[model samples]
Target: MSLEIRIAAPEDAFAACTVLRRSITECCVADHKDDPAILGAWLGNKTPQTVASWFESPTNYSLVALKDGAVIGVSLLTGAGKLALCYLLPEARGLGAGKAMLAKVEETACNWGVKAVQLHSTATGEEFFASQGYVRSGHVRSPYGVDTIFFWKQLDRGAAPDTSQRKRFCNCNSA
Candidate 1:
């Protein structure tokens, strides 16, 4: 089945949250404690109000993947590029939806002149992002109470200065 991709609107926040929450709970298991208390406080307890706040934030951007009129995946960008959240339903996995979502998020970041994009990734997703050009920054303990690897990618601006020039300039005596 084909999927339709679009920028998420305010009204779609709740549904988007559902997809995110589910994906995190199921797919992020290896990255977090399975204890109900921790899981509930972290992922299972997200409310529509929180999701709506994200949609209303000027610096945040969300994209949704729709198949058969249902939101199957979502990617949210925040901090003008400092952070990102992406999740996909199990049924939607391995269909290029994740890649497509990341592509759109990077495009959005480029439009906003963001220098890079970063995300805290689960062990499973670490490899996925690596395949998509993200490099592991380090591992961090999740604010929600778990540990995961962090990854980031510098966006290719297509017309930016080459690294050689920057390195040469950094050597002051090179003048």
Candidate 2:
């Protein structure tokens, strides 16, 4: 399968939203446990309009991974160094899309002078993040009632670690 990753455009919002919603609803079953309430709360803001807004935000960098011209994965990185979203369709897992998207995100962070990248990973995604060199920082109960793992990676070895406490922007509620 041919895969391509690029900056998301406003027109890509609907397709990106589909990937986000499907990835959360299907691939994240471990985190949501098929609970309708949890799913509803998690997916509440994953609409086309919201996705377009995210793409349009100046402080945010959104990306889409296409498999044969169809968007199959989506990711977002904030100016504050938060990896707010990194998700793939259930069918897109194990195809290097996540890793490729993550590499691009890290590259973007570096280009923007970001020293570290942080994210809250769902149970299903923890392993993938860990494999990509993210360190497990802590754990927290998400606003949507799921236990999430916080991970961070230092991009610059010379940069001091970020120690100040900041509010987390979980993948489930990044807006």
Candidate 3:
């Protein structure tokens, strides 16, 4: 199967949301521990409309990973260089889709001239993020009742776009 990663469109919200929910419910058992209260709160705002709004937000860059034209993974990066979300269908976890999406997120962060990228990783995702060069920074109890691991990666700003040449429209360092 071929995997493709691209900017997410509003129309992809449903499929992306599905992937997000499934990934959390199935793959994140270590984090939520099958606790209905934690899962419910964590997934409360993951609706299609919310996902569509995320795709449309000027401060966010959203991406979807497609496997043979089906959305199998989704990710979002903020202008401030936070990886707000990254999820993949359980069946798609071992594939390279997650890595591709992360590369794209880092590329976009560099384009925005971000110095670092941060994320709160679930228990299931800690090793994956660590393998991708993220350093564990701290730990926190999420509002949804899950214990989360914080990770950050300092980007190579040398490859970032020159701020002098482009109009600063985001809250990133370029601005």
lDDT of 3 by residue, 92-163 (tens): 988999999999999899889888999999989999999999999999888999999999998984565557
Model 2 residue 113 distance off true place after TM-score fit, in angstroms: 1.1
Candidate 3: where are CA atoms >4 Å away? 157-175
lDDT (Cα, tens digit) per residue for candidate 2, span 93-118: 99999999999999999999999999
Candidate lDDT (C-alpha), each:
0.81, 0.94, 0.94
Worst 10-residue lDDT window for candidate 1 reads: 161-170
How well does candidate 2 match the true structure in TM-score terms?
A: 0.89
Per-residue accuracy of model 1 over 10-38 as CA lDDT, tens digit each: 88888888887888788878766577766
Could you tell me the lDDT of residue 116 within candidate 1?
A: 86
lDDT of 2 at 120: 94
